[model samples]
Target: MAPRPPQQKVVTLTDPKAIRALAHPARQRVIDELYGGSVLTATEAARLCGLTPSAMSYHLRALEKWGIVVRDEAGEDARERPWRAAAKDLRIDHSGHGAATTAATRAFAATFVAPLVEELLAWAGSDRRGQLDGTSMSRGRMWLTTEEAKALVDQVVALMAPYEERTAADHPEGAAQFSSFWSLMRRPEGSAAD
Candidate 1:
């Protein structure tokens, strides 16, 4: 037998129910556990997330139904089935969905985004935060043609590809997770309704 790859390439979510299901804190933890191609049984996941096994099982089942997680066929057991994330990362596009879905997406985003803000604040307050850590953040406005904006995003993703493909074996020591967030949107001003 051979080993599976370290990660699945990607999974995109457009279904509102799936997005809403993922919005819950506990389920988000479950998804995080399975990131980077890791697999875990409900019991193991529950322990990590501080949830009861049954509660974790319920969340896993919901994720499974949404195709966000799947039974780890190689590790499946009659006693306790294991699961893995369907992709190394998820891409969500709800622009095609209606207002309710947009609202749900906002709520889902807050679940993760708010924590990132707090984490940044905590790090900034701590002595361990070093100026040379390569962490950078910024906000600015740009005037660009639609084509130009698309090209900018493509360049950003290209720059991130190598880092995103890394595995623990690549570093072998002191490896850690890093996060980045970006969005490019047109201002609501000057629109017809406005």
Candidate 2:
């Protein structure tokens, strides 16, 4: 399963600075690992992301400043503790307007959404997709009032909440990690909600 918030706290970020900080490709990769059940020290994360320890420390600090990640409790000797994702889910609210914000928002979208698209394309072209039993590719649109849309998203979130607390070891046999992304967005030529 994809990363789910342990406490069902899906952080909605409207701060451009925070978004910008998170949009770095290496930082986003590190965040994915942390969220996906890796509690990593700076050195470990650096090795995972192909950065030097100091450079990883810089990225980790930027994420820490935004509360996107936090250091776990220290060892007995006060060595650099491992870091974990502060939230399982992150939503970027791109309601801000400005050139810098626009750039940041674009970068954020690329970092998060590109992998989904790439994975889907690869799956579609491969024989493995035919062997899979539970893969899902769903897309549809509805004319929902804004309030109704919010309610729909809430229901979906609630559906996911129970899975949040499960660990890899707790998973049943034959279970595999899944990657998915969902979005509800208006079409560019969309009319006002009915």
Winning model by lDDT:
2
**Cα lDDT tens digits for candidate 2, 93-126:** 8778888789888888888776677788988898
**Estimated TM-score for each candidate:** 0.80, 0.83
Clashes of each: 0, 0
| Candidate of highest TM-score | 2
RMSD to the true structure for each prediction, in A, is 3.5, 3.7
Residue 92 lDDT (model 2): 80
Candidate 2 global TM-score: 0.83
State, as a TM-score between 0 and 1, how close model 1 is to the true structure. 0.80
- How much lDDT does candidate 1 score? 0.76
lDDT per residue as tens, model 1, 64-126: 897788877545356887787787667776676598788779889888677578778988898
